[model samples]
Target: REDPSDAIVLKSGLHLDKPLDILFDTKAGTIGTSSLRRIAQLKQLNPEIKIQDVRGNLNTRLAKLDDKNGDYSALILASAGLKRSDFNGRISHQLRDNWYYAVGQGALAIETRVGDTFTLDLLKPLIDLKTTYECLAERTFMQQLEGGCSVPIGVHTSWNNDNQSLLTLEGIVLSLDGRTKVQNKMTIDLNERLVNANIDDSSCPFNYTDIAINQMSDHIVVNKLRNSAILGYELAQSLTELGAKRILDAIKRQ
Candidate 1:
C-alpha cells in the first residue's frame, strides 16, 4: 500500500490507551521507539501483561512465530527489509505515521575514521545532504535514549529548504504487547557552515561527484539535528517515566 494509506491503516489499529510491545531486528534500525511507547500505555491499564524479546534472521524469525511451541505473539520487521528479502507476507503489523520507519534503516552508510584525510575526501562527495541530516537526527535520538536496534522505536524525518534549513522529525515509542503507544514531533534550523577541506570533487585518490553540496558545512547542521532528535527523545522519556513503566511492570507480572 502507499505510505499515506498504510499509515492510515496502522494508525487506526493502535490502542493508545492500552499497553502493547513490539520486537524488531537490529538492521531495522530506529523504528522501535514508537512501538515501546504504545505498549507502555497498554501496560498502564492491564499491569499484568508480558513483553519479551525474540531474535533471528528474516525468514527464520518469522518461522518461529508460526511454530506452535514458539512464544512470540507478534513480529516486527522493517517494511524495506521485508520487501528486500521478499518476505512481505511476514509483516503482520505495520506501524502508523507517528510510529514510522527510522532515518536510514533501509539505506547504506559510508563512514571513515576522523583524521583519515584520504578516505574523508573520497567519501565526502558521495554524501547525500537530505539523507545525512535525517539519519543524523534519528541516530542522535537513539543515542540519547540509550536504546539499541532491539527497542520498539521508530523515527521519520523531513527537510524544508525554502529559506533556512528546517527539519521535522516524528518519533514513537511502544510497549511489547503492541497495546500502548506515545508519539511526538520536533523541528530545527539547519545552520550552514564551511565544507570540510578534505571533501572535493577533484579526480584525486577518491573520485566522487559533488551533488547538492551546500555552501554551509554539515557539521553545525548535524549538531542541530542531533539536538532536535534529543528533544523528541526527552519527550518520550517523560511519557515513559510517568506511565510507561507502570505498564511494563504490570506486563511483567503476567
Candidate 2:
C-alpha cells in the first residue's frame, strides 16, 4: 500500500452500484448533494420510494430500514461498508452498472508530504499503476468543475479491462432539486500520449511531474498519468458545454 508521491489511489471501487435508494454517506460531511441525483434518478422510475433522514452508523440504519413501521422501505449503502462490518449478508441487491457516484467515491489515497523523496521512493513498489492513473483522471475532473463533497457531482471512471491505458470517464452535475442535470463522457487512449520528450514545457503543461528518474519511477508513467488528467479536463469542459455550469450555478445559489 506504499506508493510514493504526494497522493496516490490506494484503491477505488469503494462505491455501490446504482439501485441505492438514498445517497447514504456516513464518512462525508456533505450528503445533501450526493442524494439528489441518484434519488431523483431512481424515484423517476420508482415513485413509491421516499427519502427520509436517518442518522446513525451502518447497523443502526439497517435496523431502521428493517422496522416495519419505519418510513424507510430501503436504505442505500456502500457494499464496501457492508463487507467491512461483516454484514455482507445484509446486502440483498447491488446496483453496479451505470451507477454514478460521488467523485472519488470508491477511491482511497496514500498521502505524503510533497517532495518527500525518501518516503515516495519507498512506496513505488506497491503502486497499482492503472488504478492510480484512473484516479488522477477522476480527481482532475472533479477539480476542473470545482466539485467537492458538498457539490452534487457524480462520476464514474474505469480503465478498459483488457487495455489499462484506455480510460472512460462519465460525469453528472445536478441541480440541488435534482430536477436538472447535465452529463457527458469521454475516452482517452494513453497510448496516444505525447511521444516527443524534448518538447517545450510551456506548450504542453501537465500536473504530472518527477516520478521516473528522480523518484525511481518510469518516465513514461508520469506521461500516462498526465494523459489521464487531460482526459478529465476535457470531459469537464464537455459537460460544461452541455450546460453543466448552469446546473452548478443554480446549486451554488442554494
Candidate 3:
C-alpha cells in the first residue's frame, strides 16, 4: 500500500486520508475494482491522504518498503511471490480473506515444451491439486469474460470437506474506478469420484497437491474467501452495466 503522507482530493469530491495502493504490476496484472473500493474506503476515512504512483518488479517494490531510509512505510506484493522466492518471512501481513487476490497468485505453475513427459513426471508431485482446480475455475471465469491483465477481476475456490466432498468456485469483476463491482459463486460435489481417485491405490494416488485442495475446500476459513469472490463477481457485472465503463474511460484518459 502506498503511503502518501500528503493529501489530495479526488474527482468524486472525496478526500484521501492516506496514500492508497492502486498500482498493479504487469506481473500481477490488472486487479479487480473491488480491491480499489477498499482503497476508496480508506480514503473516505482519511480525507487528507495522498496517492502516488510507484513502479517496479516484485523484488524492487519490496526494497522500497524495506529501504532503511524510510522512503516508504509498507509494500503489498502477491502472496505467491513469497513462496516462489522462498521469502515467506518478508510478508508483513497476509490479506487472505478480506483482500481478494489475483487468480493463481499464491500458486505455482509448471510449463514445459510440448512432449516433455519426463519433466512433467518430475514436477507432477510438486503440483497442488486443489490449487490447480481452484485456479482452473478462476482462469475459466476470467477467460470466459474475455478479460486480460488490465481487467479488474478476482476469483477464489474451495471444497466442501463434509462427508461429501464438493468443489465450490467464486469469481469477481470490477471497473477501474472504485464505484462498481460484481461477483459469482458455484459449487460441485467431488466426493464420489474425486475423493475415490485420491484413496484408490490403483489410481495415480493423491499427493499434497490433492490434499492441499481438499484441505482448502474443507477448511472453515476458506468459506469466507469463496463467498467473497462470488459477491465480488456479481457486483462487478452490475457495476459494468451501470456506467462503470464511464469511470474506466475517465481513468484511462487521465
Candidate 4:
C-alpha cells in the first residue's frame, strides 16, 4: 500500500504530459491545501498547466476522469482512500514526498458526543497511540495557527522507534495561488516527554517484553499526547514568526 496523500491518478495507460488540467475536489478540505501545493510544483515544471475544482465522491470523480468529459487530463486523490478501496494499482503517480499532506490524513477519528461516557469507554482501547500522538500534534498546530479545514495548511508526522521514541512533525502553509509558501519541522523525544510529565525515569519500571513498548502504556501514551501538542504549538509559532501568519491571512481574505 502506498501513502496516497496528494497522489495523482491518471487514466489507465496514460502518462503525464505538458499543460494538463488536474482535477481535484474543492469540497474536500485537503484539495484546497494540497492541490495548491501540487499546482505550484507543476507550475515550476510547466507554467501553462492548471488545476480545476471538481466535486464528487471517489466513484463519481473516477467516472468523470475515465469519461474525459471534464477536460481533466488526470485526477489527484488521497492514496489512503484508493488503497482502502483496493484501487492501488490505478495510481499513476505517487506525487513527491516533499509535499506535505493534510493534517491527520489517512488516520481515523473517533468522535463521541458530550456525556457519552459509554461510547468513549468503548473507543479507548481502539485508539492507536502513535497515530493519536501524530494527530494531536497536527491538530494542535492547526489550532495554534488559527487554521481551519478550508485553510491551505498541511502537515506530516512520524514516530521514530530508535534509541528513544522520537516524534517528528513537519508542516506548511501555502498561498491560494500556489506562489508563497512557508514550512517548518520539529522533533521531540517521547521518553523525555514522559519525564517532563513527572514520571521519574529512574523510578519508572519499563517492561521490554514487546518491542513496540507497552511499559506503563497509558501513562507514557498520555504524556506523549501532551508533548505532541506542545511540539505542534511550538512549531506553529515558529512558522508564524517566519511569516506564515501573513500568508494565511491573505488566503483567508480571498
Score candidate 4 by lDDT.
0.64
Give the per-residue lDDT digits (tens) of candidate 2, residues 100-169. 7655555455667756768767877766676666666777777778777667777777668998778898
TM-score of each: 0.51, 0.74, 0.54, 0.78
Give me the runs in candidate 1 sitting further than 4 Å from their true place. 1-52, 68-73, 100-104, 145-154, 159-165, 172-183, 189-254
lDDT of each model, Cα atoms only? 0.48, 0.59, 0.44, 0.64
Judged by whole-model lDDT over C-alpha atoms, candidate 2 comes out at 0.59
Q: Which has the better TM-score: candidate 1, or candidate 3? A: 3
Residue 15 lDDT in candidate 1: 33
The predicted structure with the larger lDDT, 2 or 3, is 2
In candidate 3, what are the lDDT values of residues 1-254, reduced to their tens digit? 11101121111222224323323222212221223433443333334333333467656655544555533444445555554667655544455443455655555555565545577667766765555555544554454354546655565556676633466665555554434555556665433222322123221112211212223434442442243233333334554565555554554566
Answer with 3 or 4, whichever has the higher TM-score. Answer: 4
The runs of at least 3 residues in candidate 3 whose Cα sits more than 4 Å from the true structure, single-residue gaps closed, are 1-51, 68-71, 83-86, 115-127, 191-254
TM-score ranking, best first = 4, 2, 3, 1
How many residue pairs clash in all the candidates, one count each? 53, 5, 27, 1
TM-score between model 1 and native: 0.51
Q: Candidate 3 at residue 136, lDDT?
A: 49
What lDDT is reached at residue 216 by model 2?
26
Ranking 2 against 4 by TM-score, winner: 4
Task: Give a tens-digit lDDT track for model 4, residues 51-159.
Answer: 5666678887777667734455567778898888888877766764677777777877655564465676676677667776677677778877888667778787876
What lDDT score goes with residue 25 in model 2? 30
